[model samples]
Target: MTLKQALNRTREIFVANNIADARLESELLLRHTLNISQTQLYIDINQELSPEQEKAFWHLVKRRLNGEPTVYITGHREFYGLDFYVDPNVLIPRPESELLVEKALKLAQHQPGVTIAEIGTGCGAIAISLALNLPQAKIYATDISAPALKVARANCQKHGVLNRVRLLLGDMLDSLPQPVDLIVANLPYVKESELLAQFPVSSEPRLALNGGPDGLERIRQLCRQLNGKLRPEGYLLLEIGQGQETAVTTFLSNLLPSAEIEVTPDLSGIDRVVSLHLT
Candidate 1:
């Protein structure tokens, strides 16, 4: 089968199953299967696929039809224009989390020696992205799951930030050796009650998505720990779920009554990122 034929077939199958972004996912899976770049894929769009290649491509499509995420099949995800190694071990990095990186970059600007901590670093996409952008900054990437840290460590090395982004094994702020000038987290904000019902996300490690009854459990605990782990006047940027703005902001406000709290929306205008500037 030609590359174009394979791509079309995959897209058709994905669309029939009601998968969102069917065309994009089809191209991504095809590129991954052939280990080719998008540019090359298009350049050879009419090239015939070897029997083995065609079989391998169909196998991945089958996995996707069975509810496995395409990123897991590809074992790669892109965040903030950087490629990350991902698997079932860590939550796949989401584009919405890029807001956290952007805000942190601006906050850490001109402060070459600034210290930053990323709670629940998952695949280390956020920490490594910041480290690469702010080479002089001290960055700590922490996760409670040992296996998740392994994935983060690999990405740190892949991005050549091994010497810069420290991978620590601990929960939230507990692993930070010292208070940081900036704390950014995309902690699991999915309500525990809703976790099991969320597909694709349900395939991710429960440790990375469970946030107790209200989906603010982890966010709340991180807020409570800001006293010692966050320096005076430091900034905290958190990615939250829809309808969580009031609860998360109220919690942060009551905890640090004098701090400045702000919520930023994603492209969809959802209240996705909550920012707090400590006084």
Candidate 2:
């Protein structure tokens, strides 16, 4: 079949299979299969798809049909305009996460040579992006899973900010050598009951998504420990799951009553991030 015809059929299959963003997903799969850019696709729309290419495309289609995340299939994802390596070992980076980075940037502004810590540094997307954007800042990133840390480290190198990021393998900041000027995290916040209904939890790592019964277990623990780890008057920024802002804010308030805690919305207008000052 011609390349255009093959892509048409793949798009139909993806849409019929209930794949979200069907056209974009099909184009990505085809681009991976053909080792070409999306722009190139239109230029070569009439090119014939060899039997081997067709077979490989079908394999990827099957995986997507089974609800696997496309980033895992592509083995990479772009964050803050930089590509990062990703695997099942790490949670896929989301658009909502950019809010956390923005908050961190604003908080760190004018604080040259500032130090920051990022808990659950999945794929090192947040830490690397922060390091890239705030060149004068030094970032410490931690993850409980070693495999996830491995992916995060590789991503730091890919972004050429490894020199600015120190990677730690431990739960939260348990293994850090010292406290930082700012602490940022996008840790697991989905309650077990909620996760039971949504997400391929069984497919992804449990440690990355399960935040106990109330979905604020990790956030609570982190908040309690943050006072000791954040410098006096330091800042804390977090990316929360949907419907989690109020709970997270309360948790922060109880931990530091004098601290200023605020919930910020993402570009989509969802309460997606929380910021706290260690007053």
> Which of the numbered candidates is closest to the native, going by highest TM-score?
1
RMSD of each: 1.2, 1.4
Q: For candidate 2, lDDT tens digit of each residue in 1-279? A: 888888789889988877778888888888988989889999999988899999999899889888787878988788878888889998888878988888899889789989999999988999999999899998899988999989988988888888889999887778878878999999888998878687853467778889999888888888878756899989888888888887788767877899998888898888988988877
**lDDT computed for candidate 1:** 0.92
Please write out the lDDT profile of model 1 over residues 1-279, one tens digit for every residue.
999999898888888999999999999999999999999999999999999999999999999988899999999899999899999999989888898999899989889899999999999999999999998999999999999999999999999989999899987788789999999999988898887687443588888888899999999999888888899989999999989999998888888899999999999999999999988
Q: What would the TM-scores of all predictions be?
A: 0.97, 0.96
TM-score of 1: 0.97
